[model samples]
Target: MKSGCQWRMMPKDFPPWQTVYDHFSRWNKAGVWECALDKLNERYRHSKKRAVPSYAIIDSQSVKTVYASEERGIDGGKKIKGRKRHIIVDTVGNLLHVSVHRANINDTKTGVAVFERAAEKYPSIKAFSGDAGYRGTAVTFVEERLKLKLNISTKIKDVFAVLPIRWLVERTFAWLNGFRRLAKYVEILTATAENMIRIAMVRLTLAKLP
Candidate 1:
């Protein structure tokens, strides 16, 4: 995944590409990647003397797709025809959850689902922060329904500045960019795409452990 090498093009001296893909596909469908990320995350947090995250940053990135990819759409705002990766990350830039979907869907419409899913898994999170795109009823849903807070920071016009909290998620996106496979959403299924992201984060967390 780091090299973005085609499965069949993988060099010899390793397990056959078919065997490797078989395990990846099976584990992705079984949520093995998510479990691995969670455990590694716990270990990393403990090593840092940090408790479970109390707040998370949420954002989405739209990327183009291969011609034969499935379930695609155009993000008119971003003017990209592909898919959006909706993700929530902890304050220090650790990814907490990810949801892949059609790019055309507005962030406010589906952003809450990712937050809710993460909240259910990590009940300690008390609030979230995001950009202006996530404004509207989603804010109410977060504060009123879930009884959590959502901070929406509008970008400063005519100037460049990295807004606090929100920048952590942007940085996480930058970290994902280091993995060449994430250069584009190349998976046939959105689930597979999401799993690929989880695997990347798991590898990142492992690097920080003993």
Candidate 2:
């Protein structure tokens, strides 16, 4: 296939393109990716000797797509193109939740789902940090449903204070980009794209294991 041809030209040794493609496709079909994320989250919770995250930082990023058919028209606002990636990261920068949707979905709308899911999984989250996009209902839900305080950065000064802590999640995303499959939006199905993200996270965690 086309992917195999691209792999052949690369300098490093890799599994046959067909094998990589098939593994990813099968895992996505079986919902194995989500299950893997849950497992990793549980591992982090149980293995940590100190304490669970008290504050979490949430954000979304836009990943551009080359194929028009792959693009979903979710009013990306000023950045009106590609898909949206919603991620919730712990204060220390470990990923807690991740979701992918069409480009136009409001960040607030998705924030609730991410918070709900994270609370159900971790149950120890006490606070969350996000950008202004998460101000409205999302903030309300975190305080009411999850009983966690919300800290959303708005002004330049607040941004400066939170940027250092927030960079952990961004760094993780950068690590994900090392995988060629994530370098570009190649998966036609949304589920497959999510599976790729989960796989990258699992691989990253395993690499860090002592």
Candidate 3:
């Protein structure tokens, strides 16, 4: 699946395509991928002499999905007809949480949903930073309800200037793009797509550690 090939087109050297796919589905349901990524994150953070992050950065990417995709919508601003991937990453750009949703969804709405989910998984997270897309009343809702600061980076007037904190999540998205499967939203099931992101981050995190 990481190869992003059709199940039937799996290499002959590999196990039967059906068997491989079934195992993958089972692992996703069993939370194997999530657990592995969590361990790798913990180990990597420790290796870097940092505790699990209390602050994170959140952002979303609009990705074009295949024709067969069911959970997709058009992102009018980007003019992309597909799904959006909302992700939160720690200070050093490690995955903290990921949410897949329709492209048409409002960034603030999606941010709320993803942040609520992240709050559950990462209770230590007390603050997060985002771009202008996530600004407005939603920032207050997160702070008052989730008790986490939603720091919105000031919109940069200079195109070349790097915005603090917000840029880290953008870099994390770039790292995810390195995985072929993530170049586009190829997974038919949203859960599978989320797992793929987790798997890619797991590999990247583990590789960073001794």
Best by TM-score: 1
Candidate with the greatest lDDT versus the true structure = 1
Q: RMSD in angstroms, candidate 3? A: 1.4
* Each model's lDDT: 0.88, 0.72, 0.87
Number of backbone clashes in candidate 2: 2
TM-score (C-alpha, index-matched) for candidate 1 = 0.96
How many clashing residue pairs appear in each of the predictions shown? Answer: 0, 2, 0
Clashing pairs in 2: 74-104, 75-104
lDDT per residue, candidate 2, 83-160, as tens digits?
Answer: 777888775456787887778778888789988887887777778788788989999998887888888876657344
Residue-wise lDDT of candidate 3 within 35-138, one digit each (tens)? 99888888888888887789989889999999888689999999999999999899977898898988998998778878888888988898888888898766
Report residue 199 deviation for candidate 2 (angstroms). 1.4
The predicted structure with the larger lDDT, 2 or 3, is: 3
TM-score of each: 0.96, 0.77, 0.94
Give the per-residue lDDT of model 1 (tens digit) for 1-210: 799989999989879999998998889888999999988888888877777999898999999998778879999888998999998998767789999998998899889898789889999999999888889978988998899999898877769997867888888889899999999988989999999999899888888787
